[model samples]
Target: MALAKGTRLGPYEILSFIGAGGMGDVYRAWDTRLERDVAIKVLAERLACEPRSLARFRTEAKSIAALSHPNILSIYDAELEHPPLFLVTELLEGVTLRQQIGRSAIPWRRAVQIGSEVADGLATAHDARIIHRDLKPENIFVTARGAIKILDFGLARFKPAFQGKPGSRATTVSEGGSLMGTVGYLAPEQARGETVTAATDIFSLGCVLYEMVSGHRAFNLASPASTLAAILNDDPRPVADYVADVPEELDRWIGHCLRKDEKARPQSARDLGLVLRDLLAEPTAHGRTGAEFESLAVLPFFTSASSPDAEYLADGITETLINQFAQLQHLRVIARSTVFRHKGKDADPIELGRELAVSAVLTGRIFQRGDVLVIAAELINVRDGLHLWGQQYKRPLTDIFAIEEDISREISERLRVRFAPREQSRLVKRYTESPKAYQLYLKGRFLWNKRAIESMRQALRYFEQAVEEDASYARAYAGLADCTSMLAIYGALDPRLGGKRARAAQEMALQIDPDLSEAYASRGFSLLLFDWKFREAESVLRHAVHLNSGDAPAHQWLGFALGLTGQLEEARGAMRIAQQLDPFSASINTTAVFPVYWAHLFEEAIEGFRAAVELHPGYWMAHYYMGLTYAHKGEFGQAILALRHAAEIGDSIWRYSGLGYVYAQAGRPQQARSVLKKLDELGRHQYVPLIYSAAVYAGLGETDQAVEWLRRAAEQRDWMIAWLHVDPIWDSIRSDPRLQGIRVDLGPKP
Candidate 1:
């Protein structure tokens, strides 16, 4: 019987009922003294009065109270002196393993992970000579963070019970002659009602592993008696029958656990844990761990005999395949921005892989006929430049959806990745049935990736058409949000108006598909740039990474959020991960240089930004950042040259501002004032960031004029104001009275 809400047992006050089970009723209770939520497991009133049941409850507490492990539930306190006889434990926030299994069959890799953690927990208890007789899905909990916890140690028996005498330190309880464990998970020895040891727990864990991987009970039958009899007499069905393509090694391992003879079963839980770890870390043919070899890059496909309109078609196919690979949890796909850097460049596979830090490269060619598409794709091993897999497909243009699915499946097979059914479905999930809408969405993405104001505005139009073509296009809405935020950040649109549009588009994207990782990323960037909601940005960006760890922009944005909070080390770590995922991306590379520069590593920043400039010689931002680094080091000549190149490559207010600031610092006030005049004249006709004018004034030591412009910049919501606290460029004005309270006016650190 569940305790009613507000029921009080000792210092624990029941807030709500959590669940009820055969052993006890669990309630969500608040520990008054500690002011923390706890789970109270209360035995039934009838069981509380039975002498045997009371002894068992006390024994269970004493056994668990002596053990301490992260994966094992802790007994906080026991109220046995009172009639209800309740035990309190930490309140866990997650679904039970039984509920998880009910949702979908667990992937084999995930099953191994869950089982390995559970085995480690069991080994800890076994070290103290305790054996869990009831290890089943209902008793295993999977936390939101993927951590596994073993529950219901109350049904456990001390290992010394097998020797006919309990250990001196072990608490003794009656081993009733009735069935004590779930029939589906019973060990052969438990079925025979014989003395059980640590081996009994091993057997039960095997049953759990089989069910987790195969989604079927190992010994399920028409009745409980038949299930118990099958456990002692019949073997579980072959795992391959339930799960195709299970690794041969895993099959053998699970079989060893299910051996009816106790002597043939795995000897110890510790040894089993070691075996599972080895299986997970096994090296592939490339002589690296399976995970290391899973790195991949999909290069832009070469278009053959294609018209201008068909150019987007070829690139769209490659982009679609790259996106499909992203859904594979086992594969680390390089971001499209990085891979596209190699477009139209003749780079060797090995060289590209070394530069990108990936083990494989996917390259292909696409040719379009009137209503047909011919695609030839190959996966090359970067170590030896060997072709691991290659395929050619000629399909109706409308069949591009199925072609994407086929290519994804072949790549997974060649790479030795075994996707669970849910993963397979997600990898090929169709967001839109309209080819026209998908093509429009792809064109919009193509333009959005350019990151220019006009290009983004054009992308917004394409996305609008895409949504009109198919009202349920989630990615198109995400693109809409992305373009809208960039418009606000670049000062092309009013921040207040653009922020509302971006939020609405992102919200619509999530409404269509709640698990869209890209939508979360777009929302995160909008929050960071337009809303200045750093905490919300961090939360959504973290969720984006959790959904797709290979998302380079999410990692980069998360780094920005972390950096704003002064977590410089953590921020650098996240940026490094982004660099790994998108090494050749000019924006990612430029952003990576900032944290190093902010940390006052000017020398490192110069070297890194210089390399980025060399890698993408025409990438204006690299030169812009290199100029800033040189200016900080007082290398006026080099800084002028770099800033001049940035201006010549693309004229922008910030570039001219950098040029003017360098000129003034170099003792050329005439040139600096001339550049400021140019900015002032340009501001009359076009939008010029107020911070640019302020930088020039700051450089010329015009304190009043500088502060005036800075005030206008803050009022206008300039995005560059985010660097006010740490930017060395503002050091000259740091001690000014007007700048004293400005940080409080600006948003929080990040």
Candidate 2:
């Protein structure tokens, strides 16, 4: 029975018929819960109504659902309690491999690539003792972006193994049954009605690979009867006979798969796939193969949307892609902070590549046209300035996931950068299936990067909306946590309130996805600030870096934690890696001076802050730190100027705190009192950080009040309380009993 459009089956609305097959009729459908397109295959009545077939279908479906390989069509849902038994899978867009080959014979190298991908998917299935008894090109799909997906993973088990005549379909009996398979490609034992194993599928794959390059069936004869006889008694003509230029190794590989003795053939699909992939491992004519391709720079993608909102969208895309590429093993992808500084510059790709000292440069343009998002990318070689590979994708906005996956994988393939299987599996790993949630998260990140009071607040709202849309979105939760904690760090919110919210969100994020590296980094920062647990924070931050060495923030946090413990050399090493990973980030460049300033290297720290200000002149973070360093060096004039600039540029509590501290240190006690009066007015409307009062008091030689305020700062979980050991401002009252007690209560920074 054909289900008409709008027909509902278990929350899936049938949109239209996709195709009909012996197993069932496939329909394009919408999954109401996920709000995404899906393909539903309703079993044919013959198989649906048969008790034996129905029982086996459940077993096979359950097994197939457990296999998660990229090359296999994903099974989302399986219903079998009643009639109309069906399975749901991700909808694909492309021709079948049969259609691709029918149009023309593929080159031997291309054929090898296809075969290797197929065996990779099969290897996962075989590991679970679930073989695709019917391994043929007709059951293989070639996605639009050239990905190979194995189709009909377990459908062959839904009925009698076989039934037909010579020159027609084959036949097999019921009871003590095996998975269904085609006769022309069957192994010798399977053809003799004997026990079939994974080796049987290997033999079938040999036949398919043979035809891919030779354009002829491996065992065709005068009749199907003769074909079966040949399978039992003979081997087909050597593949080299059909194509003289075919590699000799491929002929031997096929010969091994067709061995009459089952044990003599390759024992597993995994081994066969590795063998096939190894054939393509030789260096390509135009590009580097291994370490050479590791040095890459993914420049900020340009956008043509002509609006501030679209500008954020473009930057979000570039950053997301950089993060994705950074996880690939052996690839030293340029971090977003560094590459984004070059955005909108009209420099040549090759010139930028040479300046960045990278082997290749990936430049891209994103054009938004209503519902369609056009993304064009080109990878150019630095050594020769040749276009190694390029592609333009004009797809619906919802296809962003597919587009990114294709671009990353294609580049990895083009560059011949090999990754272990586990790493490869994570290359396109998604944090959320909801496109709406993902977009909102991107916007949240874009706004959060602005590092202003209002922008951070606005970013929190977007992140909250994203989590509401998809509660399982760990990355969104991580964003919400980071934003919340930053508000406290900047003194916009009370530390108690902000830390509570941040910890709650961070816990949820980790619970949802434990391996999420950013969430771990966020937790590490909270531990240092709110709990003053430097050792625990350092270990957690190190694990975060271990999870993703490309996560620059992880390295930066590790440096900060190490610096507080007086591990100067180790702290500088971590900061250097962070700088190497994200060299141009004003935040990074400024924070990197923390150890230098703490070690009393005032001149060096001032130079570092100056470098950061030159990179981003308006960045208040650099100016604020610069003022602190100059005051410690007794350069009161320059110190006051930096603090004034910081106050003018930013709208945060730090805007005036540093200035007030400098005034007291310069013996302008009256001006310092006026600044404290201003703070008193501001306190009526917000939670003012106690550190501001402590710093000013310490500078004024009021040791008792300074220590009392320092105690209060520690009690309130102030963001800067950990600086007690490093800030020279605190040294004046180091002998105060209350300050010593506060330091002991804070549990060891040094």
Candidate 3:
């Protein structure tokens, strides 16, 4: 009854069975003649004997083979044979939407986008008079590129094949089945055994969208009869009730799709797709926006200073002014890391505008002699390379804060950007007046943005030096908090000491200036990583965003906080905004590593790290995350390669433990044990390493030894404990009483 390895069907050599269901068995097969991989679906011999079932199978094959859309699965060939009748379709690598929904609900925008594509595919099929009677979550697949495709047209009905006239005959029902579609997703008319139409497919797609947004099916019933009764008599729960963050306008659109009466629903799939696209096109409405120009890019200032230190200071000034205005929602300032790339180059303003995708670019020149500071700035329209506004500031050396505020206000007013009253007050509050301290703080931030352990340490040195020079420099304190928090996360500093210093720095910053949003984001990240106080971290991160809507780091930190709290949908949205603000940022991409690691989605994390490494090959943290992702996915050889690469870049002690797990998994127990010994010799055999050793033992099938190490990891409060419940690598030991005890000891899920 089952297709075994080496089984030959038609022109394909079946490699192995992939999966099976009531309809047929799917196999990973080799197309010997074509020399390529293909999925072969073979109908059961019993089903093939039934004339009606055989006709439906052939009709499905023919229907899909004729109608081709990018979002619809392609049917390659069909064969009618003596033993097994088979249909071959394109093989896809990624999981289905059904699997995705099991982990977390898709964001409203992404859900709408996927829904729109599915509708487009179905509308194409419907135009050709083909109706997919069964449309469910399992039938919709998401590709590696994040595109959607509809699969399994096994039950599709073709009107042209059944009738001779165009829209002249009423639709007919097949006699083989009573209930035509999946129970929970069945349309009302379809459940009542009425003629199937395009409206039926539209209703079913609406159910899929509802499931994607709410993480639940539209209907709940035990049997087909019960499901039919509910479909006829009951109203589906409003989507807003389940996902409160979804816009009300989106809820209204979905509500229309799920209407019980056929006429009340969308007239066609094409019409429904347009509505969904419109929903996704709406700008995010959940947060506050600044009153002034919401987005701006600060170009490198023109400077002819002979001293490199002065050149650095001039660049720092440009950065400082950009950071100052970044807080206002009305002004969206491009991150310094992205704009600074064009420094010292003759870049056309219009070309820079097109590349940076900003409406305006601000360029400036600075000249400082003795205690006198002179600066000139101009805002240029990127589209036309014309000056929008210009200003000149002459200030005493001690009044640098006044200079920064004056420049920021001029830019804001020239752009006519609106600011909230509270935001205006915060933007006006000067953190310090010392030019020397401000220069040091800016240099520290610039190095910190490099996101490497050595750079972060150097940045911390400068920040601490700035604070020592002037204790009341609030921005310097904020920079210190950021560096310390990052050091703890990267395992470059002791969590206890780093967290204490980070908190102290943040407290001092806020004490001196409560309007410092970067300090809040920094402190929030520290709380999330060290204290594991998720609620407090989320509160602080939200406050950071509210205080400074244009702060990319604040939104980035907020994304991490939400992800830590298992609010993945909102986390994804926040992450999107961060990416938009810093599109070329290595640091922003690396941030995904921690959240994905904590979430135990090692495969996704591995792909993300690979992308990050490609973007910045010198980034050791990306290599480290890649090693972890490989270790989780059971690719020990690749894991070792990545971990070794990380160690080669910088001897990070964290990779030693990960390498131990990879060694054990690859069946090199001696190497694994030796790595553990080396870790002990280095005095880095902490809880994380112990957990890795436990996983290595488990991989070696040493249950008792694995349990012993797991116990140690739990007692030490190892971070990996958070993923114990869902990590697939531990599936072998999950049933053990010792592992269950360890899970309970680690406290409830975060």
Candidate 4:
């Protein structure tokens, strides 16, 4: 019988039923005795009445109650009553690892950390001779504090089995004469009916870890029998086959744990825990650095001076120092626009670090008196709230550039960074000798970093004005290149004209000072997007990093190029570096957008765009992407809302096709027809617009109209055909012969 809300069981008062599974029915309950919330897992009525099963359940509860690791869910009470046999556990407010994995694969560092914690909890349990018979993603919970907790110890087993209770009906045999655990995750020995040991848990943990990394099951099959067959006869595809970036050593280690023979696996959970703990301790042990040094946020320098002009000069000096440091290849320097958020605020470094997910933070103060400048800089380690480095610089105003260089060199040295020759040159080159022009250039960069079309135009104006003020200003030309490149990207400028201008601006900037890495990054974007010279784009993007290892924009653009070229792992690594540099940046928040979009990962694109919009509400482009994602997902109302918001924010009409398609599909045929009519009236309905119309019409079951529009789209040679195989929206029409013909006409598969 189902328990109703408010039902009392032992000392717990039932609040509401949460869920029920094969093992038990979970309920949200109030621990009246303890005055706190708890979750009560009551065994099935039949199982509860079975004396032997109840005895085993009690035994398992006692076994779990003894383990006290923070990562293991605490069991508060276990009781037997007339109606229900239940175990009360501390209530968790967060979702399970299963839910998170289904949403999206966790980052490698986070996965490792979570896995390590799980291993630690298992170690504690295994030390007490308790083994979890079932270990899967569903049993791992992530708390709001970002800690991992292992649950479901109510099914765990201890050594030395006892006899069944009097009048008990429970037997040792599993249902269906199969393994007791979930099929895909069961250990080989368990499946073969062999007695389970701690190694079985380790083997199951290996499967969980593998799924976390690869986003697929280790023993996937069409049926239970087939799944069992694979478990007995097959070896899983190497983890590296699915995710190329997984380190070989880590893969081998996990493989060892998944060995068919229990003895071949780790001897105990404690041994596996030790290995994971050691991996966590070594920053670069797995041939990757885990989460260390991914990004840095450089807070604007606070000035003690009262004069506004003096403060501006101090700010300019700070920017110059940042620019110089940004030339280092391994450091991603958060652009000034993003870093300014912390200006003048008494920010807690640790809180900021956690929020931003950056490894280090740089903050300082500057003072100007007459012809002298006094600057103090400090780097704080975010993890430990410890000061990693600090320096005080007092120098003549005339030698401000030298002071900036000295600061960069010292920081790099302290961080054990080795600068490439191009990076060294970029760091040493003075952008402008005139203080006014330098200040104007800094202001221009700050505006350009906003990444909005209007901001780009304003930034271009500032750059032009700066150049007029100082003809030899290399940084101003770099600023112009950045602005023009952004305009070209958003379709705000005709590629033919904008590409030429961007190329000219970048070339001029490099001619003025060949060491300007930002100029090269801009040039790379132009080449990649307009010139379509993939090789040249790759070379330039690589050189940009070589020229300025610390330049966050270089890493960002490089990631973009690599992603477009299908080098996803390398692209993600580059983006990770960019994210590390500017954890809170609007651009960084949306870094995954370009990758997902280019790869036609529509679902991931939708999620990335949503995350971006949440992080920076003013980013109209994010809204635009969200609309595109919604259109692809067949969520027409949401698509229209997002598109309208983008339009209200004055976004360009480049996303019209997506908006029009969604409108048509959402039963707003008149509105879609009107938009298409308007586009035709404006002579702006391109191949993509026609193709989108085809999809919308097809979704509305207007087959003939869909075919006609698709023919037009095919005639015009829509570029998106390269993604047809993977595009989810096309699923509705993929089976139609006409659609197949169009696919053939578009050339071989993308």
The model with the greatest lDDT is 2
lDDT of 2 at 445: 93
Best by TM-score: 2
Tens-digit lDDT track of model 2 for 289-360: 422477889998877523334566688778887888787768888888788778888577778888888898
Position 223, candidate 3: lDDT: 73
**Per-model TM against the reference:** 0.59, 0.62, 0.54, 0.49
Model 4 lDDT per residue over 1-750, tens place: 668988998778999988887667889999775566788988888887667567657766787678766567868787765556788887777789999898997654456556766777787787776778778999898754344678776567675431223442222236547456778888887778767777778888999888888888899899988998898888899988989877676778788888998789888676676576455445674775433564566677877533334566656666776676665666656666566767777566557766766677777767677787767676665765434445556677667677777767666654555566566666666778886687678678666756677888888898988999998888788788777766755546655566677788888888998766778888887766656554567778899877666667778878866765667777888988877666556776676566666566778888888988998888676887788678776777788999778767744545565566677678888877776766566456321235656655665667777778877755543433433544455666667787666542211212
Per-candidate alpha-carbon RMSD to the true structure? 24.4, 13.9, 24.5, 22.4
- Residue by residue across 1-750, what tens digits does model 1's lDDT show? 567888889889999988887657889999886666789999888888778777668867877886766567867899878778889987788899999999987878778867877887888888988887889998899755344678887777666544335443222223555777778887887777766777778999999999988989888899998888898899988898999967879878998999998889887898998787567657777887643457788888877533345678778878888877876788888888878877877566567777887888877767677888777676766754434545557688888888888888777765777564577777878999998899899899888877777898899999999999998999999988888888776657766677789899999999999999999999888777666667778888999988877788999999887776667888889999999888778888888777787877899999989988988788777898799789889898899999999988853456788889888888899999999899889878877778887888888888899888887776766667667666777888867898655542224443
lDDT for each residue of candidate 3 in 443-472, tens digit (9 for 90 to 100):
897687667778999999999989988999
At residue 36, candidate 4 shows an lDDT of 64
> How high is the lDDT of residue 598 in model 2?
86
Candidate 1 structure, TM-score to reference: 0.59
Q: lDDT: which is higher, 2 or 4?
A: 2
Per-model lDDT: 0.80, 0.81, 0.74, 0.70
* Backbone collision tally, model 1: 1
